[model samples]
Target: MPLLEAHGLIKSFGGLRATDTVDLAVEPGTVHALIGPNGAGKSTLVNLLSGRILPDAGRIVLQGQDISKAPAYRRVQMGIAYTFQITSVFPNMTIEANVELAAMARHKARDAMAQAVDHALETVGLSDRRQQLAGDLAYGHQRLLEIALGIVQKPSLLILDEPTQGLGDAEVQWFVDLLKSLRSETTLLLIEHNMDVVMAVADTITVLQFGRVLASGDPESIQSNAAVQSAYLGG
Candidate 1:
C-alpha cells in the first residue's frame, strides 16, 4: 500500500468548497509534487492532512491506519511531519535549541533530543551554525532550520509547502538538491509554485484546479498534458 492515501477528501468553509473530493496516493521514499494556481486548495489540503483542520468528509489513511479523526499531535506521533510555507522557528532561541525542542517533543528522552539536534544540523549542513540565533540567520537558513525541526525525528512522511518561496536562484537550487537527497530516505509531499524545481524532482505530479484534481501522472505525462499546460503552465 502507498504510505499515505487521501480518499474522497472534502473540506468546505460555509458555502465555499476549498477541497472537493480529492483523492491522492503517495508512495514511500518518493517525491510527489502537488501543483496548481494561487487559489487551488494546495494549502487547504495540506492543512487537512496535518490535522490543522478536519475534513468535512472522507478518510485519510497512513500505513493502513485511519487518521481522518486524529489530532495534530497524534498525527505527528504517527510519523507525519509538516512544514509551513512561512518560516516557523523560535526567533529568540538558538538554532540548536529550536531543533532540541522539536526533538524533545518527538522523543521525550534527553539523549534522543541531543542526537536529534545533532542529526538535524548535520542533515542540512548547518552544524557549524547551530549556536546562532534562529532570527539572526539568513532567510534560507531560517527555512532550513524550520525543516530541521520538522524532520529531527525522522518522520516517515514529510510535507513541505512552498519551501522555496522567496529564495533566489542559487538558494532555490540548493533546496531542490536538498529535497532530492531527502527522497531517498523519506516520502515527500511537496506543494510548490516553482514548476521547474517540481519537474526536476518529482517522480509523480498531481495538478489541481478549483479545488479538484485536474490530472495526475508521472512527470513526463504531466509536462505534456494539454489541460495542465493551459491551467497552470500558461503558454
Candidate 2:
C-alpha cells in the first residue's frame, strides 16, 4: 500500500471549489510531483494533506490510519512535515538555533535533540554557518535552512511547496542535488512550478486543472499526455 493516500478529497470555498474530488497516492521512497497552472488547487491540496485545512469531504490515510480530521500539529507528529514556498525561518535567530528549535519540538531528550540539530545542519550543508544569523545568509542558504527545519525530525513524508521558487539557476541546481540525496531517506510530495526540476526529480507526476486532477502517470507518460500538455505545459 502507498504510504499516504487521499480519497475523493473535496474542499470548497463558497462557490469556488478549491479541491474537487482529488485523489492522490504517495508511495514510500519516491518523489511525487503535483504540477499545474496557478489556481489549479495545488496549494489547496497541499494544505489539505498537511492538515492545515480540513477537507470538506474525503479521507486522508497515512500508514493505513485515517487522518482527514487531524490537526496540523497532529499531522506533524504523525511523521508529516511541510516546507512553505516562502522561507519560514527565524531570520533573527542563528542557523543552529533555528534547527535546534525544530529538533526540540520533535525530541524530548536533550542529547537526541542536539544530535538531530547537528545532523540537520550538516545534511543541509549549513554546519559552517551554524552561528550566523539566518538573515545574514544568502537567500539560497536560508531556503536550505528552512528545509533543514522540516527534515530534522526525520518525517516519513516531506511536503515541499515550491522549494526552488526564488532560486537562481545555480541555486536551483543545488536544491535539485539536495533533493536527490534525500529520496532514499524519506517520501517526497513536491508542489512545484519549475517543470524542468519536476521532470528531473519526480518519479510520478499528477497534473491538476481547475481544482481537479487532469492526469497522473510516470514522467514520460505525463510528458506525452495530450491533456497534460494542453492544460499545464502550454502545448
Candidate 3:
C-alpha cells in the first residue's frame, strides 16, 4: 500500500483556488518531490498535507488512516514530521539539546531519547558539534540541524518545504547525498525549486501548474515531459 494518499484535495484562498482537485500518492521508502513554478500552489498543497491548513474538500490518507481532519499534533503522533523552508532550531540550545527536545516528544524514556538524539546527530554529521549552540552554526549547518530535528521524530512520512532554498553549491550537493542515504529509512515528500537536487535524489517527481497536476513520473520522464518542460523547465 502507498504510505500516503491525497484524493481530490482542494483548498482556496479568498477567490483563488490554491489547490484544485489534486491527487497524489507516495509509496513507502521513496523520495517523492513536488516541483513547480511560483504561485503554482506547491506550498498550499504542502500545507494541506501537513495539517497547517485544512482542505476545503477531499481526504488525506496516511498509512490507510484518514487524516484530513486530524490536527497537526495528531498527525505527528501518527508519524508525520514536517520541516519548514525556514530554519526552526532553537538558537540558544546546544545541537544535542535541540534534537533532544524532538526526541523527548517521541521517546518518553531517558535511554531511548539518548539513543535517538545520538543517532540523529550522527546521521546528520553533527555528533562532533553536539555542544555547539544552534545560533553559532553557519546557515548550511543550521539547515542540517532542522533535518536532524525531523529524523529524530522517526516519522513514517517526512514533509520538507524547500529544504535547500539557500545554500552554496557544495552544500546542496551534500544535502543530495544525505537524502539518498535516508531513502531506506523513511519516505520523503519535499517541495524543491532546485532542478539539480530534484533530479539527483527524487525517485518520483510530480509537477504542478496553476494548482493542478501537470505531470508525475520518474526523473527522466518528468525532465522530458513536454508540458513540464514548457511550464516549469523553460524548454
Superposing every Cα of model 1 onto the true structure, what RMSD results? 0.9
* Superposed model 2: Cα runs more than 4 Å off: none
- The estimated TM-scores of all candidates read 0.98, 0.98, 0.97
Task: Give the distance in Å from residue 130's predicted Cα in candidate 3 to where it truly belongs.
Answer: 1.2
Q: Point out the worst 10-residue segment of candidate 3 by lDDT.
A: 103-112
Cα lDDT listed for each candidate: 0.90, 0.92, 0.91
Ranking by lDDT: 2, 3, 1
Off by over 4 Å in 3: none
Q: What is candidate 2's local distance difference test score?
A: 0.92
lDDT for residue 14 in candidate 1, whole number 0-100? 86
* Count of residue pairs whose backbone atoms collide, per candidate: 0, 0, 0
Candidate 1 residue lDDT tens string, 33-66: 9999998999999999999999999999999999
Residue 157 displacement in candidate 1 (angstroms): 0.2
